[model samples]
Target: MKKESRQKESLGRILKYMKKYWLFLGLSIALAVISVILTLYIPILTGDAIDYIVDKGKVDFTYITPILKKMVVVILITAAAQWIMNVCNNKMTYNIVRDIRKDAIRKIEILPLKYLDAHSYGEIVSRVIADVDQFADGLLMGFTQLFTGVVTIIGTLGFMLSVNVKITAVVVFLTPLSFVVAGFIAKKTFSMFKLQSETRGEQTALIDEMIGNQKIVQAFSHEDEALESFDEINERLEKYSLRALFFSSITNPSTRFINALVYAGVGVFGAVSAIHGGISVGQLSCFLSYANQYTKPFNEISGVVTELQNALACAARVFELIDEEAQVPDAEDAVVLEEVKGDVDLEHVYFSYEPGQKLIEDFNLHVNPGERVAIVGPTGCGKTTLINLLMRFYDVNSGTIRVSGVPVKDMTRSSLRSSYGMVLQETWLKEGTIRENICMGKPDATDEEMMEAAKASHAHNFIKRLPKGYDTVIAEDGGNLSQGQKQLLCIARVMLCLPPMLILDEATSSIDTRTEMKIQEAFGRMMKGRTSFIVAHRLSTIEEADIILVMKDGHIIEQGNHEELLQKNGFYAALYNSQFAQS
Candidate 1:
């Protein structure tokens, strides 16, 4: 029941977009009605033409020609009306899909980091592109079939009843048996299709992972293993897809068989009625035509039901993404933080990515405005998690993180995030000109301001060497640039932001020591008045920090300046000595 409700809800959301083009859709529906009405006349006219031929007992052109001409006119008008309706349907369907795609893109922008992390890039991409495309095609087919089918069925039945009620009753009784078969098969197929959609998502994710990490796969000599893994996922997808298609395919034939039974029954019953003078031969002919027309729509609907099932499955996947519980809603009265003073305080903070698996517990910290703090830790020691909390990427499970004396939770996310500039170890650069990537943090930045930022980050020289300098379009994710160069561009982005607070996560790890010193010197200048949190593995990088935090597990085991921590000869001392001790 819940699954059915969700499907209905997904359909409702799709129809909401259709409401925008209601005028066109209504016109399409109106045209379909007219076309079906005109079509229904053809059977009646055909029957009349048959009767006229019988009455003449010879080929009398005078009587037959008029009825034949009327038939031709009706056929032509119905064809024309159907053509117009199709044009309207295509326009409305395409436009609706376009709008749906736009919404999916926008939803990706607002989705939380956790959601992005949980789902594979391939899975998300599949939902946005492939699934949506399938949904659009299915919706279009389903709409056309549904509208025409229902109209024809109703109109055909009404005409049949008029010709002879008894024959129409036989159709009504048998037609429902077709529906029962269709409904049972449809019920069986729905679960299969849903499983297929999920398997497809997993398969897509596997493909993306393999393709993106092809180098690693080759380096590890895991080609056969990768193929085996992919084959496993592919096999599952194939299994479910085949099952869904098999069951769905049964619907049309089963329904058609039932329709054939109705046709045969109509033939026998109508012949007996006509022989007994209960109905004329003309009425019998009309009833046969109406029976075909009536059942024809049922067959079309049965076919469309399969398509609709697929569409609903795809749509369910899409809605699952769009309906993801949005980032815990910001406090209603969340205030904007302007001209941030950069004082940061973490009071007995507790956090965990997963419940009962606490990564940070009873964490407390305080920093005066404009202080430079270096956080050093072993891998998975909550170093980056601290930054995530400070930046409000993930809220602390308990306790408060305050910036400039205001709880981070009390501030709007945009305003809070805008107050801080961040540069991470893994640099991200979109497909755009070098200048645009640097200016992304401040889109309205002047060329001079941008160039100054590039120079400060020591990225100016290499950028100047590029064929188009700052105007050079970087390939997607800066694939055209070296790792160090990409890091430099990311630094330049943070430099351009000039936020009052900075979070540098292995900010210079990619750079050579010499270039690192140059950028560090520039960072020294930039850090003068800004509250800076530097996360680094290299002990050499944090020597100048005003405060050094040595973290182990989830707790701050030591806090002091580099010189003081050295004297303590504890965890920080062992950590610092180990790096140079090997050399």
Candidate 2:
């Protein structure tokens, strides 16, 4: 129910964009009314000609020519008016759809990082594409049909009553009876349609998951299993689609039958009234024409209503995404971090992904300006969590983290992030030239400056070896490059940013030892006069760090330079000897 209301709110919001085209809307309705009124004249002309022939012995141009000429005029006017309506309606639809898509995309951009982390990628994709499509049909197209249909129905019914009041009663009497059937079938069809959409969303999600993990599927030879799972989702979607189709099919035929019965009654009554001399030939003709206008509008309206329900379901999903709170709403008074000195401090910081399990408990660390710190621990000892907190990716639950002297939460996210350069254990490279990837770190950096940063990270030599050097094309995720090469490129990229602080999380773990030595030397150059945090399991990598902190199960158990930790014979020493310092 909340989802439904959200979708409705989205629809209402869309109207504001549409409200700009109010003139077009009014013009389209005006044209449709004129076209419908002109069309109603056709049936009147048909019946009037018949009545004239029956009342007189001979037919002459005087009696028939005027009606024929009037019909030609009506046809030309209707054709012109219809062309105008189609043009205006189409223009209106385009503008509305464009704005809606833009709003959805723009909102997605400001959505918090946590929201993106929480939701499945496939579900997000579906909301943007599949859900917005619903509003395209019902909200926009339905708006078009509704305005035109109401105008036509009203014009037709009014003409009918003015022509012969008594006969018009019979035609309208049948309308109320059809409503009962329309209401029942609309309810059933909507339920089935909703089921179909749910299944399709599931199927989309399954396919997205399978494709994203295609490497695992091929490695484990589980392609067939994946295919079977996909088929199950497909089958459910098909079943629901078929059920909706059946119920929707009931609506049109049922309306057609009701229309047929009403037409027959109107014809019989007209004949009897005319024969008794109570009505004229032209009068009955006009009455039937008016009745036709009413029935015709409803004839198509029933189908449109079913489609509206389907669109409504889609709208619900889209609004659900747009309504999600932003990932990081900026503080009203967030100060820009002009130039941070990279003095970082953490005090009594505690955090947990869930309530009961703390990932970091009372974690405290201080890195003065230009100091170099290395954090080492077991895999789950909150190594990465510390980095994440420092980056302000997640705010602490019970403590304060400061950059310089200000709490991180008080700084705008963009400003806080701009002060640090980070190279993760895993690296990513967009499919582009090496130069483009590096320059992305500092969009406005000079070419000489970028190359200098790359040189400092030891990436310049490898880049020079490529055929086109910096222009060499990398495959998606830089798959063509070795893991170490990608890591080196990421290193160069972050280094180019020249941020006040640098974080190298297992930065050298993937490279060959020989390359690690060269990169380490280059990293020493990169870290000069910059506060740096290095997280590594390799004890040899951190021996030169000014401060070495050892963590275990969310607590900082040991802190000192490497030589000091080795002397303590605690967790850090045991870990180093067992993994690195032993052999």
Candidate 3:
């Protein structure tokens, strides 16, 4: 999109959020108007005091007292009005920011898996935190100044014109030049600010990656390499930031110079009129004050043009994220999968993570209810990708995967996913008690039920040994627990879910031999009478599976039970023998 159109769209989105606070906004504007009027009256009173003293050619206490008193009262009222205006503007800005954050967060939930996969988590987090904060702060400063600045301009001009039209005309003519300068600099700075924002996100992503993998960096002795990489990113951010700020900084000086010319013009022209008797000395004083006030807003806006540009760039990014296409909608006739039987079938399925890659083509599979199917493959062999397709995280390029004769695509995602329980290689645990984490899959599960699930997954012993048992709060990502223990807790969660279809992808890969034996026993009990799909690198784990399929390059090269696959001496046999030899 063109920058202008994008900015307009972003601004329109911002205004939509502000629309809900119309009453407060109106009150803010009303207070600004009153403040501006009261403020403008001060210069008039000052001019009146000058005229009175000049006429008498002496200090007249009686005459000057009321004017001074009224000026003080007006100043007090303007101060009060400004305070109320600020309160309203702050309330409106924060409320709008709150809504923006809510929508952004909600959008992330519904976004397609592909989008999240392609973007780094740190970049998304930057948009949620740093970018949003920058936008909100800039908007607050811009709107507060914008409202009062505009009122000051209009009111100052009216008073100036009433004092002397000729001087008012001079000031008005020179004012647009200030905006022209500001606009030119703003145009040059915007693209730089955008680059700066992008660079900042990259820097944040690098930091996040490094911090998350600190152990690996230290173990590999790659601190120098990491530091060099981070320095490069930091330098890039600094370069872009310097260029953006340089261009933005030009606005203030250039506008100030233009303002200086307008002020000089008002002084000279108003003095000429006063001497010619075309306007009184008092009127000339008022005209000069009005001229300064009239041009001051332009200078004020110029001063914050940098902030405004940063806000716009940040807002554009925020709006872009909010407008990302969500996951494809469920079919109109989608059914709610319930009481699922374990049968699954795939017919002539074709899929690829990206177009033309052709990972899986013309694939077909059929498994009876309550069967255990083990998929064995090397890395990047589409092992987990197949599971992703089964869960509808990504729709197939073509063909259908059905459960119990119903095409999976015809079912709502929530319903389809609810029918299956999954435990993956990477474990995810939040900062909650062990019991709470296990109960996540079935929140209303009873204490007895949760304990039963924990015991079945072999997590009960560890829970009992913990300082506070199940009540001990897990730290972020279960840092307090071992990798094996975290995996067990995750398995416990799946056990509590009790779905008809179960997927175990490298569930025991990280565990020790002893733990694996216990987990395998737990899995054996859990897999009974349920459809199970196991993806594993350990050949021994799947020896008793009803069916074993060896995959290569997205194609199933060999299949059958453990004994049958070894007899074929095909891909499966080679894979099994290789792991057996290594062990």
Q: Which prediction has the highest TM-score against the true structure?
A: 3
Clashes within 3 Å, all models in order = 0, 3, 0
Clashing pairs in 3: none
How does candidate 3 score on lDDT?
Answer: 0.89
| Per-model TM values vs. the true structure | 0.93, 0.90, 0.95
lDDT of 1: 0.89
Considering only N, C-alpha and C atoms within 3 Å, which residue pairs clash in candidate 2? 111-327, 112-326, 112-327
Encode model 1's per-residue lDDT on 1-583: one tens digit a residue: 9878867887798889889999988998899899998998887887777776655447667887999898888888999988888888889988988887888888888787888988899999999888888888888887687898899999898888778888899999888898898888877776787889888888889899998888899999999999999999989988998999899888888988998999999999999998898987877888888888889888888878888888888888888887787777688999899879989999999999999897999999999999999999899999999999988888788999998899988889999999889999998999999999999989999999999999999999999999999999988889768999999999999999889999999999999989999999999999999999999999898899999998988999999999999999999999988999977
Using lDDT as the measure, name the better of candidate 2 and candidate 3.
3
How would the candidate models be sorted by TM-score, starting from the highest? 3, 1, 2
Q: What would the per-residue lDDT of candidate 3 be over residues 209-275, giving only the tens digit for each residue?
A: 8899899999999999999999998999999999998997787788889989999999998888889
Give the distance in Å from residue 298's predicted Cα in candidate 2 to where it truly belongs.
Answer: 1.7
Instruction: Give the lDDT ranking, best first.
Output: 1, 3, 2
Q: Model 2 TM-score?
A: 0.90
Worst 10 residues of 1 by lDDT: 51-60
Computed on alpha carbons, the lDDT of every model, listed in order, comes to 0.89, 0.82, 0.89
